[model samples]
Target: MILPPHETQAERDASAARFGAELARLTAAAGLPLPPARRLTWCTAEFEGPPATPAPHHGAEPGPPAPDRARLRGESDRYPPHLTLYRGRLPLAEGRPPDLLPALRAVSAWLAGADLAAIRRTAPFLHVQEWAFTHERTPLDRIELNWRVRMQGLAHGPYPVAREDVKALWEAAFAQPRLRRLRPVTSHYTLWFSSTPDYPFERVGASVEPLHRGGYLVRAGGGEPATVATAAEAVALAVAALPPEPV
Candidate 1:
């Protein structure tokens, strides 16, 4: 996986330290206490398409491989997983939070009842080339929704207050300057995945797939979903039927 822009490891570390200090101060000012941080799990609901045919590039040539479902699954895992342009942390309140778990269950219910067929039909494939500079450009036709469900679950098991407080905390947190700068798209889901230390982005191989034929593929070593969307309408459609929260 491509690292964020920093000249060296030392530079990256220094920057992180500085940011962490600033974040601590901000959290203090927000009247919010930091709960035990947990790794976030996430997946992308991408547009359906054919897997990109492997081709030779940069002084290399393509090699033929057998076309078996098991092999294809393995091959698909070798390519770069779809990128998540945005991420947010959801921490549970101390002394046990309320409505958090229920909120997650509510979201789960909505997702369980989600119409995958509509998402497939409405959303179109976004070529990798289109995402070359996603870090700089605001995504078009995509809204990335993030929630801190795992931390909430750990803090309070299946409690209704956990969900409510979490929603409030997130709403308040989103209004902060740091989060506003991140510019997340609306209408996405939060699923559990391995933490950053074991994040799967690094395992993505260098292959592009066709958009319409293969559907989304899993990256090798990274169990995260591979999906991409380029249109806001499609994102809205995906989340439109989800449970609504008062902002």
Candidate 2:
């Protein structure tokens, strides 16, 4: 598993120091104004992708190791910790907060100057997130409506099923009963990859490509992509992934 950028308070402090310096460097390079205290904050989301790593030249600059793409993307109990482009609730720097997001987006654009899909990904992934239980929870009805694409549902007790059918499988497992407590549910369209020897990327639909991390020029989307872990889980999701209305 990839070690997080700021796994501890001390590490966080160290990271902040380095980023402040790096941001200054970036500002100078771009001829942008620096704020008194530059900070960046991460917004809540279904799941966080990998944190940005400093460029290669920043290797010896004394910072946390970048996450391991392989392990972070693999099935492992140990996951990488996450921090935004900056640290803390407020990303503070001596200089003005640089336009980090725009910078990131700009870099992405520059990297993918022509082919929009060149660095883009559209593979499906199972994102499990916690939700509020406004109502009491119940079990599946055994016979109920199959979920359409992007329907709400949960991961199975045994394991996850095919990525494409995650929605259907989830809806089937927890067919519309009220819930009391919060629990983890599947979030879709979260996982994608370039062609890898271990986990290959195939077309799940129209416009899909065979290349893993297929975007040739630049790669976007950051975060851990956890595939369905076990054999039983795959089978369960596979069964759940069956078509809603049979021909």
Candidate 3:
């Protein structure tokens, strides 16, 4: 990360431009479709509840996705590629260094193209095999729940999942660690978007309407609405909406 001593905003933009251009060039060289970058972050909800999930056996095919179970289940020797989009930022309080997030997103459209599998793959990180995620989700906890929320993003390719298609992966993430219901006014919302595409965006479990000019009119669950200009602003607004934890 560039520190204050080394650069100004203009300098940073120059650096990011150089970085993005090279990254795109190299990505093209690799023969992989250059997709847009989706942003991410960590929070108490994702980090505090569970243990790491184990990897899937090599060559094993996943079973049909179930939606009721509240657990994410899977095994993969490889890290969940989702984390890479966020610079491998895991949802742990004590793992990974504080992110150089601005830099990671500094060069938006670092790659070319418009497909969204990259964003869909990381949706709410449901069922992450923690170990695999940041790079994992267990896959079974909220398959249905996640699908319901991420349906719009993942509804492409051969097996397009419809809202009616939801079936529980598991009923819950953990029985003992029951999630306390929020007092009617409380909720958590997250907004992730790709700056490269100008307007392509995703709301994780929140309802938002896109403005043709730019920005979004976001109304999370039962909360009041707000107009925000960027994914970062949206995340901050959502985090700010959280009711203070009881002291």
Whole-model lDDT per candidate: 0.26, 0.26, 0.29
Q: What TM-score, to 2 decimals, does candidate 1 have?
A: 0.19
Query: For candidate 1, what is the lDDT?
Result: 0.26
| Best-performing candidate as measured by TM-score | 3
Please give, for residues 1-247, the per-residue lDDT of candidate 2 as tens digits: 1223445677756655554455456646766433322232121111112443443332122355332111011111332222122111111011111334333332223222212132122111212212201110221211111121123222321122335444433333334232101121222332221111122333120111112242211112232322443333433433333324345
Predicted structure with the largest lDDT when compared to the true one: 3
Model 3 gets an lDDT of 0.29
Summarize candidate 3's per-residue lDDT along 1-247 as a digit string, tens digits: 2222223666645554543454445445554443422211111001111222335522121443211111111112221112222111122111111222211221122122111244234232322232223222332232222322233222321123332212110111111121112101112222222212112332233333444566656566576788877544544554455445578
lDDT, model 1, position 2: 19
RMSD of each: 24.1, 19.9, 18.6
